[model samples]
Target: MKDQIRSFILPGGNIAEIDTREVKACLQALMKREILIAGICAGVDVLDHAGILCDVKSTHFSDADLVTDKNVITARANAYVDFAVEVAKKLNLFASEADLQETINFWKHYQRVQ
Candidate 1:
């Protein structure tokens, strides 16, 4: 499973710091190996701190602009629907537009229910 890791997903949070060497090292390794790294909300700050978003177009919590560069994709906290759909697309998990639309519709319904 470790050898086949295709992506690293960092959940959203109010992270105050991300300078820990170990965490940085892990991110560095992921980038070196071309593993997709995704950060939601404040997690995007972590990626930015790791220098992973140097040239990568990315978005974060409270900022709705979307960014897609290299193997990274980011979106604001409230845009999780878009974020999730983009992530699936990046991973080539959706077989067709219908499949992707279904996912989007599901999430839209979930949001409405909430």
Candidate 2:
């Protein structure tokens, strides 16, 4: 699974369920290998519990929808679309910059992706 995964995306949920020994261990392992880690809303708390946000800048329930620092990506709960777009950008999922803009227009601005 390590080699198969390019990034680890953590979704917001119950803090108790999200922040656990097993999850921390997994996150630590991924961190050691320098895998991109993304967390949204309460999920950012899990990353903090895992000690992944010590030197990294992050955002949670903030005015800014998305924030990326080094290998970490964070966002507020209401910024799921922005979070996804940033992740997609980091992963190079878009064929080109124009493709990315088209996606942003369609998904974020509710415009046609033309």
Candidate 3:
């Protein structure tokens, strides 16, 4: 199960869901695997509740769009693009630096790809 997962993404939604035993257990399992875990907006609170944000630098709905520390990536409520970009970068999805920059330019900067 854990071995098959490359990353775990928790999207912003009902914060109360985090308190459930099933959610907690799943988070704990992923934490032990040390896989990439991303929490967007209110989702950051979920990660915090899971005790995975300890000693980790994270920004929750802050001025900074995205913050990536170790295997964790966090982002503000309105920073969906930044969050996706950081996760793609962490996963090495781009073939080259130019590809990454192009992606950023097109998505983040809203520039036309040339």
Best by lDDT: 2
RMSD of 2: 3.2
The candidate, 2 or 3, that scores higher on TM-score is 2
Total clashing pairs for each candidate: 3, 0, 0
* Candidate 3: pairs in clash: none
TM-scores for the candidates = 0.80, 0.88, 0.84
**Which residue pairs clash in candidate 2?**
none
State, as a TM-score between 0 and 1, how close model 1 is to the true structure.
Answer: 0.80
lDDT for each residue of candidate 3 in 1-114, tens digit (9 for 90 to 100): 557988989889778856667886788788778889999988898888888788778895346778888888999888898889889988889999999889888876675669
With a 3 Å backbone cut-off (N, CA, C), the pairs that clash in candidate 1 are 57-67, 60-76, 61-77
Order candidates by lDDT, high to low. Answer: 2, 3, 1
C-alpha RMSD in Å of predicted model 1 compared with the true structure: 3.0
- Candidates ranked by TM-score, best first? 2, 3, 1
Cα deviation of 65 in candidate 3 (Å)?
A: 2.9
Weakest lDDT window of 10 consecutive positions for candidate 2: 57-66
Off by over 4 Å in 1: 16-19, 60-64, 109-114
Q: Model 3: residues >4 Å from true position, as ranges?
A: 60-63, 109-114
